[model samples]
Target: MKIIILGAGQVGGTLAENLVGEKNEITVVDCDTSCLRELQDRFDLQVVEGYGSHPDVLEKAGAEDADMLIAVTSSDEINMTACQVAYSLFHTPTKIARIRSPNYLKYKEKLFQSQDVPVDYLIAPEQLVTNYIRRLVECPGALQVMEFADGKASLVAVKAYYGGSLVGHALSTLREHMPHIDTRVAAIFRRGRPIRPQGTTIIEADDEVFFIADTKHIRTVMSELQRLEKTYQKIIIVGGGNVGLGLAQALEKSHPSVKLIERNPQRAEYVASELAKATVFCGDASDQELLSEENVEQTDLFIAVTDDDEANIMSAMLAKRMGAAKVMVLIQRGAYVDLVQGGDIDIAISPQQATISSLLTHVRRGDIVNVYSLRRGAAEAIEAIAHGDSSTSKVVGRMISEIKLPPGTTIGAVVRGEEVLIAHDDTRIEQDDHVILFLVDKKYITDVERLFEPSPFFFF
Candidate 1:
């Protein structure tokens, strides 16, 4: 696909890095010449220098023949105006803008129309990040939680612990441990390397295990890999930015007590006024005296989402060392993500990785319904619909083992009509079934997509 991206910031840069590998024609537009130069040196794409919303800039960036325009500029007005310009002037088929303000998104029905703002898709990074964190808080010990089949099924990732009963056992023992609840071990990782799972494969401590099960049985299934922690009650968030404020507001109703700390006094007052339940403080998150005064030791979950990565990391470390049960920190750089994961921080949240999955789902070629980028984009779990009958399809009517799956791909679950079926070697795929697949390496995405394509017999 020929694409034009507005903004050379974190989200735009990560999108380019992800899409460029998939063989897309990408052109990035931004006013920062140095950022554009850096991106150009890294990837095979074009970069135009100017205000992203400017007509001349869009035209110069090849909006005339572009199939899609993505406006992820920091300014909401600029992003919205870019989409409108692309729609009115160039008639770009797909216009996706990153809209942050709830006020604008609240009127999405009226604002994003062909004759209005003209945004085909509104990608809210702050909302996505908040929801991602909420899911983690909702599930006590999960490193990552992804819902499939409209929340009927879920994919959870957790680190195996020495205390888990099944920590040093074979995968087959899961059934013996809990025979009633059906589940599947989708994939496993050790030291960032993929390990194909089998009945005889033993799960060791420190292994990152990914599993699939019915949503209701998720907690039971997760218990096999790690000791489940107590449900979160008291929470503390460092940073009064959009993500921090949004997360605090979302958790205000469910959680009994929520505390937010902001370095900026005015922003702290604003956050306190906006939130009815959450208490906001104006102080440095890394300040040991401030954290102790706020009773960080008694907090159940401490999250640092400030703009500065160093501050977020330092604050989270202090919180954990001071006796916080669990801590999560947001890191934007991919290099820093690996350095922090499985370390002092309980979970490392990547804003880029979270935002790119939604954008990539739209960019995928097949009829993909959902896409979850995992392991910092090293792997992906996708839900795609199977079309055509046995005569015209490679998957329909074929047993799971008979399908020519890619080297690192595994069909984890299948949803047919209203039933959810865990994938087995003998399980046969039927037409229209929503197949959920896990690819340890994302390079095989095209191969997986081809397996569901309709053959020439379908046209006859």
Candidate 2:
């Protein structure tokens, strides 16, 4: 695939790095010479130094024959305009834009259609991060929660605790513990190394276990690997930015004890007026006095989502130090995310990963509906629809045991219409079944895509 990415920022750089290794021709455009040079040094891709929305710049970046044009520049306007230019001038087949502002997103349904901005797909990092954090808030003790099959089934990651019922047991014992409830252990990482799960494999304490089950049964399965945590209340959010406000709005109805702290008094007041239940404070989130007044020691969850990575990390560290039970920070830089994770911060939220997943779903072949980048892009949890008959499709009529899944890949579950069935050896995939799979290694993603796609010889 030949692609033009309209930014050399975190999202663009990450996307370039991911696709460059996958046999795709990637060209990045940006105004910053230093940023473009950095990406050029790291990846084997072309770089155009100019305003991405400019027509000449798109032509210089090979947008004419590009398979996709991804506009993820810092400015929403630039991204939106770049997509319009790509569609109007180059006639690019696919155009994806990263739109952060909630105001524009409010009118997105009517705005981004072909008749208007012509953006084929819109990637809302703020909204995606909001949903990501909301899932973590809803399912306590989970390192990550990725929903699939329209929220009917979810893939959850949790650390195996020492005293958990299934911590020292073989994978087969999970069925014994919950005979009535079916679930699949997708993959396990022991000390940061992938471990392909098998029925005989014993789960050790401290291992990161990824499992798939019905969304309602998520907590029940979580308890088997680790002790269940107390439900969150008294949530404090730092920054009045889009992500912070969006999260506050989403949590307000369910959690009335939500508090939002914004350093800017005006934005804080606006947020206060918008939210009926959440308490809004116009003060520095890192201020000891302000946090003390709010009783940070008793706060169940403290989130720092300021635009600045340094500010978010520092404030979240202070919150954790001040005795917040759990602290989640929204960090964009990949380096910062690695540094903060497994330290003071409980979860380092990365919008880049979420954005990448959204983009990959569109880039991937066949009928993949949803994709979640797991374990920092090394793994992937995908939801794909099975199509065609026995002769036409590689997966449609095959049983779990009969299918040739890529190495380290595991079929987790299948959502057939309204039913969520945990994938078993005898489980057979039928047409239109939404198959959820976990791949410990995504290098064979092409094979997975081919498995879902109908044979080339088949007629439409």
Candidate 3:
């Protein structure tokens, strides 16, 4: 695929890195010559220097022959305008934009239609990051919680604790412990290496386990691997930026005892005015005195989402040191994420990973409903809709065991209409069923896509 990406910032740069490996012809446009030069040095992709929204720049970036146009510049207006220019001048087939402002999203129908802005897809990185954090808040013990099959089922990553009932037992013991519940252990990681899960595979303490189950049964299955945590309360959020403010607003209604701290007085006041219930404080999040004054030790969860990676890491480390039950920090650097995660910090949130998943949903082939990057892009979980009959589709009308799944891939669950079914060897797939799959090795993504697509030889 030939693609033109506007902006060489974090999202665009990460997108280029991932897509270039997939053999896509990628062209990136940015106003910053240094940023473009950095991207050029890292990836095998073309770089054009100019304002992304300008018509001349799009033409220079080969937008005319591009299969997709992705606008992710820092400015929302520029992102929107670039999509319009891509559609009006180049007639690009798919246009995707990263829009941050909720004000514009409120009138999405008016702003994003083909007759007007022509944005085929709109991604909100802040909103996506906020939603991702909210799920972690809801499921206190999970390292990551991602919904599949339209909320019917979910894939949860949890660390096995030493005292858990099944922590030192084989994977098959889960069935004996919770006979009535249906769940599948999709994958496991020990000391940062993938371990193919089987009935006899014993789960060791501190092993990162990924499992799929009905959304309601998630908590139950999680307890089998690790001791459940007390429901989180008294949440403290650092930074009043887009992600912090959005998360505060969301938690104000669902959770009481929410506090937001911002160093900028103006931003703090603005957030205070918007929130009805949550408390807002104007103080430096890195200030140990301020944190102690606010009773940081008693806090159930402390989340640092400041723009500065160093500040976020420092604040989160301070929180963990001060006895906060759990700490989560938003860090962009992949190396930093790997180093800090599974240490003092409970989770390291990556904005680029969240944004990349939203972009992949549009880029992937077949009728894919959603895509989630797991284990820092080493693995993936996808929800795809099955179509066609026995003769036309490789998946449809075949039992789970009969389907030709790529090695290191597992069909975890299936959603048909309103029902969620855990994937089993005897379970058969039907047309229109949403199949949720986990791939330990993402290199086999093409094989998975081919398995779901209908055979071209068959006629409708």
> Residue-wise lDDT of candidate 1 within 1-460, one digit each (tens)?
8999999998899889877877689999999999999999999999999998889989999999999999998999999999988888998999999998988988989988988789888898888999899999999999999888888888999899998988989999999999998899999998889999999999999999999987888999988789888889999999999899999989999999999999999989989989999999999989999999999999999999998999999999999999998999999887898898777888999988889888888877777878888887879999999988888888888899888899999999998877889999999998889899999989888788778778866521
Which candidate, 1 or 2, would have the higher lDDT against the true structure? 2
Q: In candidate 2, how many Å is residue 421 off?
A: 0.9
lDDT of 2 by residue, 181-272 (tens): 99999999999899989899999998999999999999998989998998898899999988889999999889859999999988988988
Clashing pairs in 1: none
lDDT-superior candidate, 1 or 3: 3
- Give the Cα-based TM-score of candidate 3 against the true structure: 0.96
The candidate that wins on TM-score is 2
- For all predicted structures, in order, the TM-scores are 0.94, 0.97, 0.96
Cα lDDT computed for each candidate against the true fold: 0.90, 0.91, 0.91
In candidate 2, which residue pairs get closer than 3 Å at backbone N, Cα or C atoms, i.e. clash? none
For model 2, the local distance difference test gives 0.91
